[model samples]
Target chain A: MINKESVIHTRNLSRSFGEILAVDRLSLAISRGEVFGLLGPNGAGKTTTVRLLAALLQPSSGEASIAGYQVGIDDQEIRRKIGLLPEAPGLYDGLTAEQNLAFYGAMYGVEEISQQIKRYLELLGLWNRRHEPVGTFSKGMRQKLAIARALLHEPEVLFLDEPTSSLDPQAARLVREFISDLKGKGRTIILCTHNLEEADRLCDRVAVLNGHLLALDSPIELRRRIFGRKVVFHLSATKTEFEPILLEFDFVNHVEQIENKIVVAVDDPDTHNPVLIRALVEAGAEIRFVGELRRRLEDVYLELMQASEGIINGTN
Target chain B: MERIKAIIIKEWREVFKNRFVFFTVSFLPLMITALPLVILFFTGRSEDFAGVTTADLPPQFSSLCSGLDGAECMLYFIVTQFILLFMMVPVIIPMTIASYSIVGEKTTRTLEPLLATPVSTLEILVGKGLAGVIPAVVATWVGYLLYAAGAHIIVSNPHVVNKLFDPLWMTAIFVVGPLLSLMGVSIAVMISSRVNDPRVAEQISGIFVLPVVGIFLGQTTGLILVNQEFILWMAGVLVVLDSILFYFAVQIFQRETILSRWK
Candidate 1:
């Protein structure tokens, strides 16, 4: 179902090159101001999906609309409403940083081009070097300039493909901070990346794709759906005797004992934990502490990718 | 229109900075214009054609130079020969620039970002086309004026100097020169779209100049005469060729093909 509040909507969107399907039967609705991530390994159609949504490439099948404008039909309008930072910085090395922004700003028919160029240049910390040719810039500087160019037009939607792929740690952090700042401005951003950590930190929801939609949800929710919630109770002694007691509770799905710790898989850890602790304490148990097992977004991403591979292998 | 202007301005900024492009646009026209003037200066001061008459001239040029002295006829023939060389200015200069326009953007990986903008494909092609044509046409006209001024100073015969302003040369420089530049740019744009290397595109597009060179050869060998009718016919053919080449260029420059298929 299409959400009326969605800024970007696609249904059964498929794009293929010759016999190889790059994106297959993918459907998604990205609401306004949401940072949606497209995550997958190489050859997973992440870039292709961004290109399709940006209206740089035509979809082989299905429909997409961005900012209420249909793709393929209103491509120029869609282009006007969106900004794309391609994988490569793709700057003109011969032109100065200010000239680069001025050219793109004019292409978008941006008013007060100089002011916009100054605003983004200062924001990206490249204002002092605006007169220098891009060829003289470092890799990090070029990436920052490219970002500024994308945002100079104040686009309603921004598509960033691997915005921090090649940067050093410090540069990457700066870019991440910039993206986070944009998030606060309530502009819808579609980030295509394989950086699970980046996605987990920046995305409200992410779609794991491998030429097809594998999974889509918030990082925490995907972890919960894949691994379920587990509460670990640290006991004062050997925990073998507490496993059966925890399993006796109907809310506890499964229980395992390992080295003075009772790991209980429960549906609702918040409410079930207190009741389980009470039962364990009443049954002559000494619980040292209680904590919920946390899974990283990396684990969730790996599990989803493994399961996708398994299904493909099983079908073959 | 603003988008097109932006592209044109962007292209000029980049093209002006390129050393090879600057050299070709500035020096080639000056050289073409000067070489003929040097030839006329030296030949006018020499004694080789001092005592010659209409009997000594080629049969094709004998009647054309009947009223002129030997040196005057010789100077007139030399100047007419260089007219086709002036046409070469427009063809070669634009090919130098237009050949690199699209393919250079591809090698630099800037085409994707440019295409992602709201600018239409036609606007881009037109902008790049004009960027290449304007300089070449302007240089050709300027070089012709320099040659005209230089010829009048070097040659004492008024009739021979007057031949430079003939309607044929006027039409060829003013009308045919711009068309040939457009034709060259269109072919370069088309070749640039399909080829991966700008040098390769330039080499292939350079083949278009051979026909003009062949005409020059034929004119010098008395096999073909470049008359007013010939200039008009060449302009007509260029108009048709430019139209066909531009249509194919737009068709081949599809956004999907460029983003996906360009290696």
Candidate 2:
């Protein structure tokens, strides 16, 4: 059943350019206020998907909607209800920051524009520089201004594509925090990015795409489902002595002794960790620390890429 | 409707704020108009002009020089003929501004955000078209007024003012100038949307001046005798041409198409 709170919904959406299929049969349902990330590599149709949903591109097939408005039929209405920050900030460099925001505010027909512009400029920490020409602003500052431009009308849904591609660490963090705050305001967001860490940290559910949907789930769920559970135990004594003893437990899927740490792969660490700990202690092995290993999303991403590659090469 | 107005205002602001566009839009009209007045001034002053009489002038110019001597007749002929070339001012200025408008947005990567708004394609087209046409038309009229004043002062003849501000000249400046400006803007809009580079779009739309020059050529070569009726007919043809170009411009302006095919 489609959730009533779903703000973005697509049914087998596809777009093609000449002979190239940029996006193919992508289906998704993103709930209101959810920060849904479309994760992919370069040329993986992430940008294409964002354009389609934003009504900047027409799908070659299927259907999509924003706030229950169909993409093609209700394009203007959809546009009115959505804010889009394209890959480039795309600021009118000749205009001052205030002018740019005001232009967009009027373009979106937002009433009380002066107050809206003031509110957004202040919220984005750009009020002091509002009078400065955007031509003089740095990439990050232009991006923040673009964000404020997108939000000036207070759209219900926001789309950001590669929001922090070229920013310094400090600027990237500021943008991330701003996006997090926007999410807190209950505005549904669709973030398209190649930055795996940003996606892992910010997305409630990420759709891994490569011309087609590969995997769709939370980061932790993807890691656990694809690579299983792994726990590393720091032992006071040689790990070799504890490895074989710990391996004897039927619940322990696999064990490896590396220096002072015994790494164990298990079906369910939450269920078997206590039993494994008692067995190790009863067997005269001193365990200092036992915790689930933090699996990097990069690993799962790479693993999925490799699997997709194999499938492409007909060797999967 | 408000969206179109906003876009027009934004475009006007951008045109004024851009130093290069500002300089050209401000000076080109004065320069084009003032050149003819200067020539008329120098010719009126030269004493050697006694050798050439009104009979030596083209038969088509005979009516304009009826009350004048050799120098004054020569001045009248030059002023009237060169004013046709002044038509190039409106064509170039508006076309220059409109040519760069869309393609410049594309280069700066600003078109996406503008297109992402709720504004219709026709609104964007009209806003930008008017942005280009309004300034060009204003400049042309102001330049014509200045030229008329300068001619009246420099030539030291009240009839010179009478000849320059004739009903025909008024029709050309008021009717032909705006329609030609709209045509230039329409061409620029059509070409700019297709081209990625602003320079290329400007160059292609620069072809607009050729037809005005063509009329000048016809008048110069005696292929067509220039008169009030000729000017009125030209304005009529321009009205039809402006309408055709406008229809195609709006039809060709697909927001999604530009966003998709843009490089």
Candidate 3:
């Protein structure tokens, strides 16, 4: 039986290929029914981490588990419980979409595999053309079939590596929505992708990894902790008059007013935003709109990569 | 066992769907078999072709002729010599199938998803190995059977038929043919695992047939005689070699190698 807590657990898990350390001393815990994202740049061990946890590749040292089964020892067991959509959909061009799904379903020992195949193919909007060879389908359709193959066994954990990397915007949206739907069913998912926006929207907690875990937190928490908080307030009155009053709070690092909008950078917007709002209203500045101007997850990701580089260069 | 069966079924589906591989595996043996018959048909009809007598026949050819006339002796010699060419079929057909199936999967990037499954490496290799070997074996036997029946019809002399259907040729085509196919599939698989290009694997695997060609050359040149004893001994050697090659083929087929090493 799978552990109710921490469907995936790792302790200092590391893997090296000759001189190159693909994944280094990684440790993490992902609870059941959580959608965790592994955010990384190319060659940052994101795929390697997924492969390691999926039991496709064994770690050189340390230990890891999927659904309470040890990675190396219970590799077949772990594989039995996990599904993977690799960077490439890797479907056989000669086989039909339904045949491809049936092949994988049989390999995973999925019972009533034809029904499972039909279910996933229909869910991905591929039931209409399931009999057509995958080679005849577009890239997005092939990817959808690959996704269906991964979920055919109804695996306990799903690992998606760059699920929408080469897809067009509309196709990407379909795959993202499908992933969101999977999350709604309380499925445990580990998505490794470079798309920060998708990660932000889907992942409950994103782990920024570059060979190791650099930052692991909710997207909102990561932005607040790394870049601090900046709240933007638009007022009907000219905001130049409210700057001094907003700066009175020590947590407010800087206050800038551009026409009728006040942009305040604060250490903690959750605590200071309300206090600043009350003062703004008390002073009789007509507030038209009040909202937090959070930093984009992309900016946070780049900053983290740059800081990690600085540490690697011994300049920090 | 079911996983292996699934892989084998998928492999057959893929092989048959590929026109070039399917044609090569199914028709190449027939083409090769036709080559010798065409040569025999023309060699018998050509005005310049002088029929050799029993005294003029080579020592290796004389044994097959035994009590035949001069023209019959010539046809007997031709039929026996062409059987050596048939051996190349098992090697060529299976090598073509195995190299293309293994390396073609790599080129298509389909191997990754298959590797990610819990199917053991042994099962995958065996499944693929049999998929290639079965068709080649059947083709070899089928082509041989066709050639034998055609030779009986085309060659009027009974001596030619007698030499073509000898126990030695029977063992070579039926027993040694499948073993050579196994060896060919194993060598192709080993090369396929190391290389990403199917063409490269196919070219390198062609080297496995050089020794068989040497035997062919030796027998035809009267340097080494091919008799029933030689056929039985060769079968023994091939069965042992096939087992060893297959064992190595399985050992070398690492899922990690396919997943990580090959780009």
Candidate 4:
């Protein structure tokens, strides 16, 4: 559950572009020290929400605050608390790695900007090429410089958009590690990404924002609440027509039968599995493997998207 | 103040770093000084391009204006035109620099992080205006100096240096230059704050300079006389324009609107 020490609070926030409603009354409280993930498909308003929180956009209606400051009115104070890594942020192609950092640091008004510039360059492993123009740096290096720019002011809240989009495996790992480090320091974070695995790993709570919020909960709560019990029963038996025999069981929701193998979903698969085995032997059908199935975060994500589509069509 | 200083320093470095910025700033000054030298070369050490040598010029040129001769008069024409041309640069730099200041960041998608900083819209505007204005004003003086040096050498008149500096030109640079620069910076910044597309902002911001150029043409064609009274009147008019520009530019710089439309 989102707690009382929320750094960001949005109330009935809505944005409409002509007839198109981009964000519809999006209201949520993000507590301090939590990593909140905003997951949605392309054009699902994830990016819009990030921009709103960053005080970059004027809401059509409603209100939002960062660190107790209103979005637009007290913009400077809000900006002080939040740092954003914008989507598709480009590098100054003519500036070297160190120069870019120094430029941003100065713009951010980071104290001892030169020292911070050195620290960030070294942290991102761009120390070796600190003098090389960002145009000459690799994609991973550019992204790293952008991140350093984000952190230059040491903001209390961070908004990371697709933070690991272009990184190599090692680089992605380093960013993830850095995020964990930030969270450990009690800094709030808002992340917009499609990486389901990363979401499961890094976030404390995730909101599936399709058009409106389809679901909002911790990953574990979502998985448990959305998907019922998954029971995988392995049955080996005579290969003669076992598929039809398995379908006869009333409790079976879906039955996929392979030659001498089957996967079944039932309200009570535990009770149903035994009955299926007995029926199979009676019918002289072969029974193969039987056990519980493993459910993944992907399944939960898809189900949430579908549920949201239903929500849009006015189905509960 | 610290933030402003930081922004100005960083912006100065950026202007120096970009080849386009360097060229735009330096090209005019080099041309300004070199024109008189070219005329002297073609006219056989005669500073006057109007075909009247300093030796045969009016007594006023050789007496009231002690340093002025036939060639020095021609040199004055060059400098005056250069000053007029220099007025255009303020508008130009602001267009290029302000177009990229915020709108460029939006295009790069860096506007998000920039907006997320603790800096106010006013602070941001001040920082950006300094970047565009400083280079433009400095370039005008640098170019004028080079022109004066070339004129002094080419005129070959020992007295030319004495009249190379004029009270009128000095007043123009010190007074009108900053006013015009502020006008440019303000209008360009206002345009940048409103739009998301850098190209569109650049184009829109650029149109504001037409009136200034029109005034220059009017003066050139004698449609408007630019006596001391006229200069003072026009300066007053520009100050009013500058105030209006400053007021709306700040008002239209709605942080929420920019942030929202920016995305």
Candidate 5:
């Protein structure tokens, strides 16, 4: 179901380069004020998808719209409504930071251009070095200046390809925080990144792609859907008898015993864990500690990618 | 229009910082202006030409240097040979700059972001074309002005100076100079859009100057005499060629082809 409030919408968007299909017939919608992440490995069409939706490349056989403007047909109107920070930070190294922003600002038809430039530069902590040519700037500094350039026009939709790909922890954290701040302001951002942890934190939802949509959902939901809720119960002793006690409950889907612990998979752990604990206690099982197994997004991503690879290899 | 202006300003800012571009635009014109004046200065002061008559000159000079004495006619003929060199100024300087424009942007990875903007392809081509043409045209005009000033100061015969400012040479400088610069810029831009290396683009663009040099050779060898009719006809041919090249440039510089194929 497509949300009525979706700011970005696409249906069967596909793009191909001669013999290779960069982006398949992928369809997805991004709602307003959502931070959506596009995650995929090398040659997975993450960048091509962004380019297609940004109207930088025409779709081979699909349709997309940004802020009510159709892609390809209304490319200029869409371009006017969006800001894009390409993968390279693509700045003029010979020009000063201020001059660079001023150039982009003018291209976007931004009014009060100086004020807009000052605001973004100061926000990115680059105002002090605004006069310096970008050639002298460090990698992190150039990335920040590129970010400032992307946000100078206060675009309605921003497509950032690897926003924090090659930055120090501090710089990456600064960018992450800035993205959070933008989220708070109700700005819609489509982020493309290889850092799954970053995507898990920043994205309201993420789409994992390998030339086609492999999976799309919130991180936690995907975790739950892929590797259902597993609750681990630690006890003084693990006996074969505890397994049957957990199996006694119809709510428990599976149970495993590992030496001194019991791992149980349930549909709703919050509602079913207590009943299983009571049954285990009655079975003379001493529960020392009971905790849910925490799964990282990395695990989910690896599982999905491996499954997709198996399907592609005809081994699934 | 404003977006085009922004691109032009940005291009000028970047172009001015290139030392090679600065040297080409500044020094080449100065050299072209001063070289002819120096030769005229020496020819006007030479003692060997004191008694030489038009009878001593080649047959081709009989009709071209009509009212002048032998020395004056010799100086006028020598100065006329530099007219084609003056035309080469606009062609050479803009080629140096325009050859680097698109290919340089691709090398630096700035083309994608610039193309992502609301500005159209035509605006970018126009902006870049004007950026190259303006400087080359300005340099040629300034060089011509200084040459004229120095000629009037150095020549004793007013007729020689008058002949230097004839309709043929004036049209060559004022009219054909800009059109040739535009043609050079269009060809360079077209080549720049396809090539990966700016040096390769420049090297290939250098082949274009041969035709103009061929004309210069023909004129100097007395095989073809340039006059008002020839200047106007050349301008007409350049106008047609500029339009065709500009159209092809726009066709070749497609955003999809550039972002995908120009690796």
Candidate 6:
């Protein structure tokens, strides 16, 4: 059990290797039970940030703490508090699935070590193949074992670096579901990923790490900020007779009839959606649902990139 | 201490897990030391080993084999084993310990997680050295036991070999053997930590063997031999050299520098 009071703090953390600045003066706070997504394009210092947090690399300047222990000063304490699943799964290739877990569990001093190994072996549905060496396991199985190793010690904070990078759609869904279940329990998670769709589904708030943080907000908040608010409705309707009724609503900025339902892109949908809903009711249309719909993360992210490029062009 | 025990167990288990490594650590020294003697026993007529070709051997070596019978000839073989294999094994000892300790972690990607653990670098070194050493020493004793058995059956005399089991070789085997291994392992570890490529570390660590091999040949060539006075002088030289190497190895093994370069 982690103390809810524990705060992941970085005062002015920085890391450099001679001429290369890997991470620079990153200061941020992550609280218990919040899933904070870290996003960046390739070579944008995301992995370096994860390594520093894991204390696998020492900071060149300033301090950061996990569970209130300073980066270099009390690094082991931070390590103990956080569960790290690195980008490439760090597992002993020749060892069996069980043996791989044992190695990590021993490192963490996890009590009842063998018992925990058994638990993960069963939990990940790898029990039957427990005796088989990990080298022979599929990529997805190996990744699940990596996640099991990370979670074996039941760490308070979890740092996941591209946890589902190599999985198939089914395997990816399973991992996303697991992450979602974990967030409900209030574990502080820092998910580092390039998969925009996956990040939108799993992250409570995401930091758009484009050279610097372009935006940080819940997925919905970010979409509305970048692409404006819109609503789409799919209705089981008296289709031809009810089609004309949606045009008279004063709150709707625009409406389009595609197939059976009306699509409305509204400026103030909070107040406008209700008026549309009532108009449908008065029009004798049996509306199944009415809700605000916005740009999927795919569109929002591309728009963000375009906006950032535009900003750079105008300034230059 | 618990962490030390865990790491040591981990190292031993890993060593045992690999058949090639386990066989090398558990049986190679014994084979290298005893297999030649076994061939000599099966094919050698008593006269071949015991004849003491006075024309070929120096007076000192000839005189030491006065009886030149089974046990007596075996005693001479034991002394030879000490001079050659004793030194050669230590050379590889450092390579195995260092490469396995550092490179194995890098291969497994356990290096980062291990460095993060509560265990300090020195403690990890102790675990590594012990893992390399205990097996090496056990293999040495196994070799000695095989020699004892072969000599008892093959030799005409039993007491002569027993008499040559003096305090010096015993001390060399028990005390100095592990010390030399520790020195080698420490140096190898420093190299391994600096170099990410295991093969490169192993190759670089192979440089440590040159001095030992040079001394072994110098002795065989009659340029040097460990008589009482000479042994005392060499002891003094070795102590000074080992101290310097020890200090240098520790100084070069900088954790921060290595981690930054791990690609």
Per-candidate interface DockQ score? 0.84, 0.78, 0.68, 0.49, 0.84, 0.36
Q: For residue B57, what is the lDDT in candidate 1?
A: 75
The DockQ-based CAPRI class assigned to model 4 is medium
Which lDDT tens digits does candidate 6 get at residues A159-267? 8999999899888887888788888887889999999888898887787765445677888888888767777776785555444676666666667777666778677
> What is each predicted model's overall lDDT from 0 to 1?
0.88, 0.86, 0.86, 0.73, 0.88, 0.70
Worst 10 residues of 3 chain B by lDDT: B44-53
Reference-based lDDT, residue A36, model 5: 90
Candidate number that wins on DockQ, 1 or 2:
1
lDDT of 4 at B33: 50
Docking tier of model 3: it is medium
lDDT of 6 by residue, B180-214 (tens): 67667777777887777767876787788787777
How far residue B50's Cα lies from its native spot in candidate 5, in Å, is 3.5
lDDT (C-alpha) at residue A225 in model 2: 88
**What DockQ does model 3 achieve?**
0.68
- Tens digits of per-residue lDDT for model 2, A1-316: 2134888999999999999999999999999888889987899999999999999889999999999899989999999999999999998888999999888888898999999989988988999999999999998899999999889888999999999999999999999999988877788889998888988898888899999999999899999989899999888866347777887889888898888888899989889999888988897778899889888888888899999999999999
Off by over 4 Å in 4: A1-4, A166-170, A233-292, A311-316, B15-18, B40-83, B100-102, B156-161, B193-225, B254-263
Q: What is the TM-score of each predicted model, taking all chains together?
A: 0.95, 0.93, 0.92, 0.81, 0.95, 0.83
Reference-based TM-score, model 2: 0.93
Give fnat of each prediction, in order: 0.88, 0.93, 0.68, 0.68, 0.83, 0.32
Q: Per-residue lDDT tens digits of candidate 3, residues A1-316?
A: 1124888999999999999998999999998999999998898999899989988888999999998899989988888898889999999888999888888987898899988988888888999999999989998998899999989988889999999999999999999999999998878999999999999999999999989889999899999889778899999956348888988888889998888899999877788878988999898888898898868899999999999999999988
Ranking according to TM-score, highest score first: 5, 1, 2, 3, 6, 4
Clashing pairs in 5: none
Residue lDDT tens for model 1, B124-197? 99999989999999999999999988888887667887888877789999999999998888888888888888
Listed per model, the TM-scores of chain A against the true chain A are 0.95, 0.96, 0.94, 0.79, 0.95, 0.82
